[model samples]
Target: MKHQKELYKEAMTVLKATSRTFFIPITFLEKELKTTVGTAYLCMRAIDEIEDDEKLPNTIKAELLHATSQLLLKPFDRNAYLKLLEPYRHQLPEVTLRLSDWLALCPEGIRNTVASSTSEMADGMAKWASKGWHIQTKEDLDEYTYYVAGLVGTMLSDIWLWGAGIKTDRELAIGYGRGLQAVNILRNQSEDKERGVQFIPDGWTRNDLFQYAEENLAKADQYNKSISKRSILMFCKIPLALAHKTLDTMRKGNNKMTRKEVEQTVEEITSE
Candidate 1:
């Protein structure tokens, strides 16, 4: 077995390689919180890669996600886990295949939470994959977002309560998660269309999606205000700020923030 230190290092490498947007903000988390959150994020990202892979048949994708969820629930079983994931290893992003390292290093409490959330997310993804990823109504959009992102909010809130002794409103955390996912949906509208996944409700305009995202962002702001610790608040604020900026850019028909804008926003949020 790899030492926890080595596993942690591998997890951090997966985190940085897979999510540059989250990497900087996650650094503001306190030591243990950082490790737990990083592990959780990487695990979720692994499932996400499976869900998002266009080349894989939906049945294969669903099977992989289901297997991953089951692996996370058990004690770390390197041989079994690797064997299960091996067939699709080349199809998934290389960073995502490091799930064993992340799972090996996760603390027990954090591990359980990560397991539960990822299992739930995997089930949701498998269900949606069977549905052909065709999100047709407002309700379907909300459900899909909850599966992919709102659960993340709940997980992070739980982590805050556990590690920082800070309680957050679960509803608001869900809203915060929904808001970020909505922003992503809007930003990736073109790409998702190309990939045959349409998150937009039938009869909804771009403006409608923007409205949905902004309302959720409003709740995200409330989520930030509810955090008592400066470190946690800062940790939450940076991403929320960037999400807001990205939404604004999207509304203006630009799908992204420039590097300079991202740096300025990060500096502004962290300086407060």
Candidate 2:
């Protein structure tokens, strides 16, 4: 078995390569929080890879997602687990292949949190994938976002409280997660359409989606304001600031933030 430091180095490598946006705030976390949150992010990213692979049949994706969730709960079985995951292995990013390693490195409480949240996300993904990734109404959109994102908010809140003693408003934290995810949906609207995944309800224009995202962001602002610790506040603020900036840029028809812009935003948040 790899030592904790080696495992953490591997996790950070995967995190930085796969999700630069998240790496920023995660880096701001204190040591234990950093490892736990990084592990959680990598765990979710693993299942997300399976769910998002366009080449896989929905049935196969559902099976793999379910299996991945199950593996996280049981003791690690290298041979059996890798065999089960092998077919989808090539399709997923390298970090996802190290899921067991990530699980092994998590502190017990955080591991349980990661396992439960990942299981819930996998179950939700399987259900939605079976239904053809459709969002037919406002309720459907909310449910979909909750599955893909809001549960993440709740998981993060649990982690924050456990790791740092920071109590977060679960409802507003869910809104924070939904706001960031809504921004992603809006930014990737065309790409999602190309993949036959329609997150937007019928009769909802871009403006409607924007309105929904902004309202959630307003709540996210409240969620951020509730954090008192400097490290935790900065950790929360970096992403929330970027989400707002991304939404603004999206409304102006420029959805991507330049590296300089991202750096400036992080610098501003960390300095405050």
Local distance difference test scores for all models: 0.86, 0.86
lDDT of 1 by residue, 18-62 (tens): 888999899988889999889888878878988988899998888
The TM-score of candidate 2 is: 0.96
> What does the lDDT read for residue 15 in candidate 2?
92
> How far out, in Å, is residue 191 in model 1?
1.3
Tens digit per residue, CA lDDT, model 2, 101-211: 888888887788888898889888888888888899999988988989998999999998898888989999889989999999999999988887889998999999999
Q: Local error of candidate 2 at 212, Å?
A: 0.8
Lowest summed lDDT across 10 adjacent residues in model 2 is found at 69-78
lDDT of 1 at 139: 95
lDDT comparing candidate 1 with the true structure: 0.86
List TM-score per model, in order: 0.96, 0.96
